[model samples]
Target: MAIDVKPALSPHLVVDDAAAAIDFYVKAFGGVEIGRVPRPDGKLIHAAVEINGAIVMLNDDFPEMTDGKSTTPPALGGTPVTIHLTVTDVDDKFQQAVDAGATVVMPLDDQFWGDRYGMVRDPFGHQWSLGQPVREVSYEEIQQAMSQA
Candidate 1:
């Protein structure tokens, strides 16, 4: 069965190995594997995982299927996008991801915007940011903090 809720916007990642990425996400972020469709050559054409009540879609990089366009991050020299995950506990989730083979891109700390936030890069070259709300900050407050920084 597919995921129950349809998200208006979901990030679709093209990875070198969809299976491995799925496994890593499950181990690191407590994601639930929704489903996967495999190609004839054993590469995944599509896969979905649910983490923190949201669905993330992924597939194996298939340049041939996309008119030789580079799809994977490494192939493109790196990705410019970072997926932000809002979790209940940023510190715990960040550590869990690190334990599961993710490399820390930033150390988790309470920010002026009132969140404990940090970033990590998955083995597939995808960057993910974990955040937990520590307190509610107004837009003006955030703007002031940004100006000061």
Candidate 2:
């Protein structure tokens, strides 16, 4: 059966370096390099990657696309949304991200939702949430949690 669904939440990051970001993503989250498009000047125009079963697309800083060229993440400070990836062992995954040049935004620990979770920001300034569901929570439990908060 053919399933029609979105593959990834593609986020465009205007980075000072694109190739380094690709390498970092690969080592951090086991991202698979799907494809890359290069411009005539031998610079990456676009690139795609599959990380933890989700597709993430990125490109170099292109002023033509955003009106003005910005080499940093954004003037607004950082990204509004954080990319979450569900893995088997979030602790190990979080460590892997750190080893791959990502900064640990949140230390690995248990959450109120009954999951071992953590967050990291890639070298290019993209934040990621790694988590592993440790136990299943019932609707009542979820309601209680919500009420407590």
Candidate 3:
């Protein structure tokens, strides 16, 4: 029998500075801290935050620990994976993140795929793609747009 999971998937971030990362998330994305468990050494063992009703788990990197084989995105050079985000107002959200210390990787623009989209790299070195659906575009429409370009 399979065990039931409340949230089957959650992104776990390992950063050099978990506390700063947590603060960044709160200010940048309006995330609320659900809880945090600190180790005896005052390092974050685990933390949970809610972003737009979804929980994101994170912790400070502890390569010394058996369970902590993870390194920060910078330590790994860069992350290939990016978090895709949707908001009611993509432009506002993108600016909010930028104002909170995220660097704009891609300027916000309307895409042929029908989304107002942009990308930002947070201070903690995580890349986020912010988007808002502007209209419903069929596959044929996308193909036509691509062909026109």
What tens-digit string does per-residue lDDT give for candidate 1 at 34-97? 9999989899999999988888999999898889886888888888999999988788899999
Candidate whose TM-score is highest: 1
lDDT for model 1, on a 0 to 1 scale? 0.93
CA lDDT of each candidate?
Answer: 0.93, 0.81, 0.90
Candidate 3 TM-score, true structure as reference? 0.90
Worst 10 residues of 3 by lDDT: 62-71
RMSD of each: 2.6, 3.3, 2.6
- If both were scored by TM-score, which would come out higher, candidate 2 or candidate 3? 3
Q: Per-residue lDDT for 45-140 in model 2, tens only?
A: 888888887678888887767667564555547877788899997888899999988888899998778889999888877788999999887878
Candidate 1: misplaced stretches above 4 Å? Answer: 1-7
Q: In model 2, which regions exceed 4 Å deviation?
A: 1-12, 69-74
RMSD of model 3, in Å?
2.6
Q: Who is ahead in TM-score, 1 or 2?
A: 1
Query: What's the CA error at residue 74 for candidate 1, in Å?
Result: 0.8
